[model samples]
Target: MARQGRHGATRRQPKGVAFDRWLDRVVTVAVLTAMVIGLTAVAAHWLL
Candidate 1:
């Protein structure tokens, strides 16, 4: 039963468009976090 449940979960996982959308979200968040940190560093440099 446990093995079957694992197989079912994997089988039901997303594909194609859904996977692309998921990857896009991950990349966007990563980029935004980088930008925010970069901007903060620049601001601190200018202030000091």
Candidate 2:
């Protein structure tokens, strides 16, 4: 077995945390929007 230290642990950002949260939301929305658009396009192609 091996021992883990602080150097090998994940570190949290201590600055601009609010901006990071906002960016995460924006990215999630963008990804969902793209998925919807792609599915709509495929459905339209098959139906028409």
Candidate 3:
């Protein structure tokens, strides 16, 4: 069961104080893309 109390269901704030919606999505996408590229490079290096 979900916990319920007087201070329950409170919205959690983002840790990034300066980030906004657009920047958040952009950063996520960029990070994911970079990770994919890095992993592909490692795999290619191992294969060749």
Candidate 4:
């Protein structure tokens, strides 16, 4: 049997879980890329 939450029943679906994992990876990569870009910009500014 699936677990019940406060509002309703909750079940872990395989497709939903896989999608969540993929989305997490994409978001993590985007954040890392943004951070690297910002750091490079700062370094360039300091050097120039």
Q: Which one is best on lDDT? A: 2
Off by over 4 Å in 2: 1-13
Error of 4 at 39 (Å): 0.2
Q: For each candidate, what is the lDDT?
A: 0.86, 0.94, 0.89, 0.91
Q: Arrange candidates by lDDT, highest first: which order?
A: 2, 4, 3, 1
Weakest 10 consecutive residues, lDDT, candidate 1?
1-10
lDDT of 1 by residue, 1-48 (tens): 444535344556455878899999999999999999999999999999
Put down candidate 2 lDDT per residue, 1-48, tens digits, no spaces.
897867846797789999999999999999999999999999999999
Q: What clash pairs does model 1 have?
A: none
* Top of the candidates by TM-score: 2
lDDT of 4 at 46: 100
Worst 10 residues of 3 by lDDT: 11-20
TM-score of each: 0.66, 0.70, 0.60, 0.69
Query: Distance from true position, residue 8, model 1, in Å?
Result: 35
Q: Name the Cα RMSD for model 1.
A: 5.6
Give the backbone clash total of model 1.
0
Stretches > 4 Å off in candidate 3: 1-19
Q: Residue-wise lDDT of candidate 4 within 1-48, one digit each (tens)?
A: 998866647765676888899999999999999999999999999999
Per-model tally of clashing residue pairs: 0, 0, 0, 0
Candidate 3 residue-wise lDDT, 1-48, digit = tens: 997857758877787746787799899999999999999999999999
